[model samples]
Target chain A: MSELLIATHGLTKVYRGGVTAVDHVDLEVRAGDVYGFLGANGSGKTTTVRMLLGLVLATEGGIELFGEAMPKAGASVLPRVGALVEGPGAYPHLSGRANLTLLDSTDGRRRRGDRRRRVGEVLEQVGLDPADRRPVRTYSLGMRQRLGLASALLRRPPLLVLDEPTNGLDPQGIREMRELLLSLNRAGTTIFLSSHLLAEIEQMSSRVGVLDRGRLVLQEDLATLQAPTGLVRVRTPDLSTALRLLDGQVVDRGEGHLVVRSPDAAALNAHLVARDVRVTELGPERRSLEEIVLAASESA
Target chain B: MIRVELVKLLTRPRTWITILALNALPTLVAVLLAVTDLGPRPGTGPPFLSAVLTDGTLFPLAALGIVLPLFLPVAVAVVGGDAIAGEVQSDTLRYLLVRPVSRLRLLVAKLVSVVVFVVLAVLAVAVVAYVEGRLLLGDAPATGVVSVSGSTLTQAEMTQRTGLAFVYVVLAMLGVAAIALFFSTLTDSAVGAALGTIGVLVASTVLLGLDAADAIKPYLMTRHWLAFVDLFRDPIRWGDVVDGVLTQLGYLVVFAGAAWANFATKDVNR
Candidate 1:
């Protein structure tokens, strides 16, 4: 029901050597959605991101950002969109502040006087020291990654397209980045995050799109993909008694547990308890994001 | 966008280092001439090398001649070649493009930056040579500079002609910049682009010496590089000067057009 901030109509890209990096992907990201684009390495995720940003021209089909035809209207539309593709890039010889200042200057729409304030704000927002005088070359990988994010956030655009945003980050840094992104999303910034990391997409994305071998193998809401199956997993101390009691309904047997073809976990547990079976752990069966993605990849 | 590029160029250490290297040869020559008090006999060396012994003001022209053949063009090639390819190498080109800087604007800014570098190098060489000539070489003869045609040149005429020669040398280097920039767009390696430009210049020089290549000699990129020397002749000959301008402009148009055609539609996968 919300507005679609990004929509691609059968977009595709084929390199000169006949390599189809992306094939007929109709990506749709609505407003206020944390769209997680999942793919394995070399599965055309980067190519799709590049096409969306107008860095790589699509060989066929079309792209629209904020409802305007993309690439053709990139000059006007891109100013409202921020992105970090592949990795962060900056002038190594320049200080972080200087690099951001120059990059910010590229957007002619921003007033010159407000640049320093904006740069400082983004640096602090990314947990970086705005006063750090060291050149970017001296910064650690994490610092450079943060700087890249800062550049993307400089304009406070309504949309952020970040590819592998948590890359090169230690656990603490990743946590901070996730928190920052979530806060931004809460403040009404739509996020299109692309990564091969399932755990990341699983945690933050409201909607998910999976790319496999240059094809959009699956696109659905994270909740839909992760919804409970019509089954219940039960761990019992008396495994034999539970198995005998639910012989025909038992679908899968694992280490110390049984998956029963029952929709209500409480009812299944009650039935087992009524038979004098000791139920240790019982819950509704739901596929993990990893399992879902793997299933999609296999089918594709 | 042009302003941003110029800021990048001016802030870069490589730019200053190249400029300093360019001035080194001319400065060293000035010191040697001052110490030994020996000048190659008139008409035997780079355009005004011998003339500088008695008239220091002419050293600027001599300095231009010293670097014009190789050093100046090499510097231009390096800077121009690095224009687009260097960004690609560092992974910044995509960021800039996605910053929504139009491909045309970026290309124009790069071309302008290269032109600024050419102008800066030529001007630096002339200024450094002027000081060295004043302090370490001779003052202008009281009768003023002796024109190449064995005629007297007033102070005003000498200064005016030197300025003209300066502009001409800058124009010549612009042709080199255009070539290097075109190559820059074709590859992501800055060194490759620079070397390719130098390779073309070297080939032009090699062919210029072979009578068998005479038919195309007049159109070679380096063909009229020395035409500025004629600016010193009394009642200056405009024939070669005009041809040199036209030839350089032709190269600029053809090569810059080729670079734009390739780059504007490039996939920018890097």
Candidate 2:
């Protein structure tokens, strides 16, 4: 098995006033995978991330990062993980470069040339000019988001945990953030990010785990889950021919219609047409991430 | 860690502005004393004011004395109060804590920053007053100190005692600093922290003023704040000054310890 960079065993967290924020979540993110944590606004996504970082205490479960138990090993484990929780919080009075430099000074690592050069490099990496002398308070919201990402990337660790990383970015900035994350993933960094934007996750993540009301509803690879979960219902005068062409993939049978499950519904339609079967209806039947989460939360 | 915090303190405009505002009272005292020579004689005014007019180097002690009652303590309260709460309010404490820095060390660094701020503010007022005193009051060497028993001490000894007085004043400010820092961990609002710390001091001072509360006065942080004045006595009355230093050191230990304890377990959602 690929090394699991992040693994939690029945991790749970219950806040004050008897509120269960996260309940028995057994989550896993392997090495070299962009694992997207999908959830609703208050579905315990941020709380889970905070627990993984040892920022918040877990009520009843265990969390291990890189095979070491955290928060006991938080000193050793946290250094190897880079995170951007909420948009980066900067000293509004200091220039962007100054803010990053101050944060970099706290890193316990070997010196790799002058610190100023590294600050400049990360600033340029995030598309922010290091020479910009304006204080962070003067930067636009998108600029702050970019600066937040730059701060996260400063350490260049093996795992990057981000919470709503593309929060305030415009479309162009979001695409750039997506590209940056993808490039980072390609370079062998395991990226675990949480977001409610399904399209963003679908486009970026290799595997996904959906959290609904403090519980994991689904966890699967994008490709594996891409297969249609149900069947496309079709009605036609030559339904018997369509049924014969679909083989044994039928999910439902009726008098003059048949329901079949297939990822390639277009290919099935072509096959039916080649056999001279008239088709009245055809479409893929799969639940969207949004609908799945909504259903799971409502049920909870 | 201290270096990072110092950089943060120096970079903020609010820091400089606070220092300037704190220094204002001393500058006014220096200017008012220079003009008209309408200074209060010994035993007629606050600590060290009469002696300050003759010797320029003595003005720093006088400045600290003038501000210590409420002005300097309030400045210390404001700086210490803002240290952690300001970061929490701005949400930058999360980034700082996420680094390899532990909560204890972070708190230590914050406390150190407040100490550094106190030193800087005191020195700013002292330096400006020293210059203003030298320019306005002329370079008269400090006169001899007359003891209550009619003994005299040299000017060099007087300067040395004044040095100790400045150092003691800084130590006194640490009591307020420690309390403010402790409150800083309790709330996310800087203003709330400042007010809370100052409120405790105000209540203590009020109790100190009440004879019915005389039994608890020795233990109160406010009681020993003005004890730095004892350093100027010809015999150098060490009794109250010693109690004052010990009282502040005790506050530092208790309050700073509590701040660390509270912050280490904080969820830090902000």
Best-fitting candidate, scored by lDDT: 1
Q: Candidate 2 lDDT, tens digit per residue, B199-225?
A: 988999999889999888998998987
Q: Considering every candidate listed, which one attains the maximal TM-score?
A: 1
Clashing pairs in 1: none
Stretches of model 1 off by over 4 angstroms after superposition: A244-247, A270-277
Which lDDT tens digits does candidate 2 get at residues A1-300? 889999999999988999999999999999999999999899899999988988888999999999999888988988889888877799888899889888999764647368788888788888999444689999988899889888888888899999999998999999999998899899999999999899888889899998988998788787677757756777789977777777888889888888887767788788788889998887877766566656656776
What lDDT does each candidate get? 0.92, 0.84
> For every candidate, what is the interface RMSD in angstroms?
0.8, 1.3
Residue-by-residue lDDT tens digits, candidate 1, A1-300: 889999999999999999998999999999999999999999999999999999889999999999999899998899889899998998988899999999999877779998989999999999887545679989888899999999999889999999999999999999999999999999999999999999999999999999999999999998898889998989988998898999899999988999899978888888889989998899998899999989998988
Worst 10 residues of 2 chain A by lDDT: A288-297
TM-score of chain A of each: 0.96, 0.84
- Chain B TM-score against the true chain B, each candidate: 0.99, 0.93
